[model samples]
Structures are given as structure tokens and as C-alpha cells.
Target: MNKQDYDIIVMGGGLAGCSSAIQLRSQGQRVLLLEQQRYPVHKLCGEFLSVEVISSFARLGILEAVRKAGAHPITRTYLTTSNGASLESELPGVGLGLSRYQLDLLLFQRAQELGADCLDGTKVNSVSGGLQQGFMVNTSQGNFSSRLVLGCHGKRSTLDLSRPFTGQYNPFVAFKGHYTGIALPGVIELHAFPGGYCGLSQIETGEINLCWIAHEKILNCKNSTLPDPLWQNPVLAARLHSMQCVRKSQHRLSQISFALKGKFDADVCMIGDSAGMITPFCGDGMAMALQSAEMAIPLVTGFLQGNLSERDLKRQYTSIWNREFRTRLQIGRLLHASFINAGIANLGVSLCDTFPALARGFIQATRGRDHGANLATSDI
Candidate 1:
């Protein structure tokens, strides 16, 4: 067998890509990580970090860096409707509210320190070949080849590969901005509106991350600017009154899809949003990204070392990945319906406020936990 230019090529420099690069490089594999954009930039994310990944970050030696970087401790959940009807519940455990600008940069630098060749401002035009015959990757910067590839290129990418879920029209358009002066300490607020819902939580710099997603048709203009209709949501209006935008501009992304994507796409191993996307309301997308990379490192290692064949590697990884995430994605899809309807959200929050125990059910339902598992709860 001829040696490829690199052992593994990780597509995109997001959480999953950088994470797998770090682990695979630590195991002596030659690694290359490509990102279309430069770092130290904000991404369209809720910036909510679940407690489940804390142990993994500690194991990866980045927990102290995260803490020192001023990651905020998130311990409470506040669910609200457009009318100001709301419910408060305790989170299953403590999570961190860290901005992607800080988190992704930290992971990118760590991967570089571990000897992974990290390249930014490189766009992937196409990906071909597979585990059996090695991979050929063409980027705006140059052409490269590797023994394997990890497609952490996010929910949508420049790659034109058609897959099972590609034909669906993705109706979601998302907006994110940073604001200050909102007293959201130790709390994450999920305020439901007509077209979509908004999330507010404090990040490392004590700034609130305001992210919301809605149907593209709801926007009065195509410029992706804030629509006044969004402010009509009473809960958001209250929060807005107490806060001011930290920046003049906001981040926007379109064509967002929550459809379940396979762990293997275009014959390349997939991770993070590439593999599957949980609706943002679940607050588990970031955790799933880190968890998928952790799950893939060993299989990626085995395949590269010739200990596992292509067929066995694909079967094992696909099976395990499906087992872990499929149910969560399905539940997220189901919950999406109830959340978007104004009447349902109004009634749900009002009922939940009256019965805190029932509100815990709503929390547990969206969270990626198995049925019959107990969730920690409290009343406020």
C-alpha cells in the first residue's frame, strides 16, 4: 500500500473536527484540519455547553483553559412563551455557557500544539475516494490526499455531494448576536415566539448570546436583518429592554436542516452536524459534537492501523452512531412541532409553570437521555 500525504484529513475546524484531530494526532497519526473561515469569529450557535462534556474536556486538558477563559456556569433553565408565560426548572447538571469564538479557537490551537496541521481560509470544493482506496480532497488552497477523511463540515457545506437528506428544502434561517446588561447569570432562557424561539445565556465575557431560528418566509426582508415581528414576542421584548447589542452587526445563517444525516456520507466518515443535527432547543448539539469525535477516534485509529477492515469499520461506527443519536434526533423533530405553534407554546408554558414536575418531563424529553432515566428537577 502506498502512503497517502496524510493519515487523516479532518474537514472543517469546528468542535468535532478539531477534537478528532487532537485525539488522532496524539496517537501518532498524521492529521490535517481545514476550515473555510478564519478563527476568533463568532458562529451561529446557542453557545450552550452541556455538563456531559465537562469530563471529556478535562480529559483533553482544556477544561482549565476554558475555566480561565471565563466560561460561565449555567445551572438553571427558564422556558417562556411569547406572551410572558414561563416555566423554570433546574438543569440535570451544571453546563458552561462559552462562546464559539473562544471555544473553537481554543480547540484549534490545542490541535495545532498536538502536531495536527491546521489550515484556515481553505474551502473544500469536493471530496472523493474512501477508506478502502484512500481519499482525494480538493480545496481552494490546494489539492490533498489522505488515508481517511472525517466530514465534520457542518450541517451544510460547499461540497455538492447529494445525499438522502439533501433534497429536502431547509426552511430555517438563524440569527445570533452578542449583547450585554442582561442579568442572566447562572441561567439560560428559552423564549418562544411565533415564527421561532430565542435563547439567552451569559458567555465568558459576561455578554448574552442571543440566537433565534425561524422560517425564512417569516422574514420581511431577505437581507437577514432583524425583523420587528420578532420583538413582538413579549418575553424577548422584556429581555431586549434590559440589554444592548455589543456589536453593530449580527451573524446569520440559512438553509439549516434538522433531518437525520448518516454517519457515513460520500464514502467519508462523518461527525458532528454532518452526521446528525439536534434542534437547537434541545441544548445538546455541542455535547453531541464532542461525543461523536470521542466515539470516532478509536475506530479511526483502528482503520488507519489496519486492525479493522473497511466493512467492519463502517458497520461498527454507523451502528453505534445511530444507536446513540437517532432517538434524540427523532424526539427533537417531534418537539419542534409543539414549539413553533403559538397556542401550544402558550398553553404548555402556563401548564408547566403550574406543575413544575410536568415541566421536568418537557426538559427530559428534549434532552438526549433514554426513557425511564431520571432527570434532576427543582421549583422556582
Candidate 2:
């Protein structure tokens, strides 16, 4: 292949893209990672990584580095409803909290170290062609070709506009910010308001990350201040009152769709949120992103190595994706819908409070199985 060509091209430098590039490069495949923004930037993410990701991080050889970067273990979860009813549950396994700014940089550097071609601040304008003829990728930097392409561009992107499975648009907007002074050690909290919910957890830097997802109409009514609805939940109110925003400006993202998306488009495979997005309060998005990248490796590698046909690759990937995530996404959507309505939200919280075992089961259901745990014991 020429210098500009690669065996694989991964668009977006988020968890899925970076991890895919790193793993593919490690397998002796030439990989190019195109990222639109430079690293060390804030993203509108909850910053809470579920225990499920620990295995993927370990497989990628960045587990220790992530911990070294200040990720703190989270074993408890606190949830509150709009009506002030609340409950706490011990997580099935430990989660880690680390800001996207730090986590993205770490993964990008690791991919580069493994010899993957990384183009930060470069945007992918369009992708054309397919597996039969390879792919012609046009980008801000230059044009390139690859035998395969992975779409890890995340929940909302221009790339998605041209895709076929761009389901009904969701009107949700999300905001995130890091703050100091509000501390909830070893715990991640989800506080439900009238129209949305906020998640609070401590990242590796001991700074609390507050991320919320809500309908645009709900935010528009706030008129440039914290929403009055959040104050209805006393726990959420006290946490917000005590914290001071660390950034000059909070990171905001709009038009986030939680609608299920297609997994494959002929030759191109979609990973992470580009594949599907879970409701935010599930606290499993980051884990899902990493796992999607991990899942892509075998199918992509098999296709590249001529061990699998293109049709088989797509079929297998789609099957695996649905088997692993379809139920979780469905449950997350149902949960999000319930939490958004004040009456249902209160009833749901009250039920959880009344039945702690049910709450634990619900958490486990949303998280899916911890592949990391199985991988740790396997000889593979």
C-alpha cells in the first residue's frame, strides 16, 4: 500500500476509534485514525466508566495507565427522583471515573505508540466505495483508501446524515462540566428532575463531573440558569449548590439521538454511538463504546485476513452487536422514558427504594455481562 493508504481507516478518535486503531495496528494491520478535534478537550459525557470496560481496557493494555491518570473506583450508586424519593445500591462491580479529556488523550497516544497513523484535527468529509473495491475516504487533510472503515464518530455527526438508518431525530440536548467542592467518594449519583436527569461522580482528578440530558424545551425554559425543576430534588439541589464550575465554559452537545442505529453499511462498520446510543442515565455509554471496538476487532481482522467473506463479516457483526446490546439499549430507552415523566419517575424510584433487590437486578440488566471478567480467566 502507498503511504496514504491503510488496511483500515477509523473515523473519530473517541474510545471506539482509538481502541480499534490500536488493536488493528497491534495485529500488524496499517490503521489510520482521523479525529476532528485535538486531544485534551472536554466532551459532554457523564465521565463514569462501567466495570464492563475494565476488561476492554485491559485487553488494550491501558488499564494501568488509565488508573495512573487518576481514575477512581466507584462501587456505589445513588439515585433520586423528582419527588425527592431516593435509593442507593451497591454496583455489581467497580466502575472507574475519568474525564474524557484525559481518557481520549491516553487512548490516542497508545494508538500512535502502536504505529497506527493518527490524524488529529482532521475531519472526514465523506466516505465512498465499499469492501469489494475498498473505500475512498475524503478528509480535511487528504484523501486515503482502506480495505475497511470503522465509523466511531459518536452519537451525532455529519457522517450520520448520509446514512440510511438515521432514525427519527431525538430532541435531547446534553451538557457536562467539571466542578470542585462537591464530593461523593466511591459513588456515582443519578438525580432525576422533571424533564431530565443529571449524573454526578468523581473523576481521577478528584473533580466531580456533572452531566445532564434533557429535552431542549426543558432547558429553554430555564432562561440561562440552572433549571428550577432540578431543585425539586433536594439531593440534586444541594450538590449543585455546593459545586463550583471548573471550566470557564461547560461543554454542551445538542441533538443527541438515543434511537437505535444500523450496525453495518456494506463495507463500512459502525462502532460506538455511531452504531447506537443508550439513554444517558444508564451510565453505560462509555463501556458500550469500548466494547463495540473490542467486538469489531475479530470481524474486521477476519475480513482483512481473508478468513471471512464480506457478507459473513457483516452478518456476524450485526448478530453479535444485537445479541450483546439490543436488549440493553431497549431497557435504557424504556428507563429514560419512565424517568422523564414526573409521575412515573417518582413511582419508579419509590419501587426501587421499596425493593432493593429489584433495583440491583435492574442495574445488572442494563450493564449486560462483564466480558472483561470472563477474559481475565480465559487463556486466550
Which numbered prediction scores highest in lDDT against the true structure?
Answer: 2
Residue 33 in model 1: lDDT: 97
Q: Model 2: how far is 235 from its true place, Å?
A: 1.3
| Local accuracy of candidate 1 as per-residue lDDT tens digits, 34-152 | 99998887888999887676766876778879878988888889888877687888777778889999999999999999999999888888888877788999999889999899999
lDDT of 2 by residue, 1-380 (tens): 33337889999999989989988988999899999998878888999988788878888989879877868888789989878788888777678889899999999999999999898999999999888888899999989998889999998888887665556666887788888987889899999888888899998888999888887777756433366776777889888888888864378887778777889765679999999988887889988898888888988999889999988998899999999999999999999989988889899889989988878777888886773443221222
Find the number of clashing residue pairs for candidate 1. Answer: 0
C-alpha lDDT of candidate 1 relative to the true structure: 0.83
RMSD of each: 3.3, 3.0
Candidate 2 residue spans exceeding 4 A from truth: 1-4, 164-167, 222-225, 371-380
TM-scores, all candidates, are 0.93, 0.94
- Which lDDT values do the candidates have, in the order given? 0.83, 0.85
The superposed Cα distance between candidate 1 and the true structure at residue 359, in angstroms, equals: 3.0
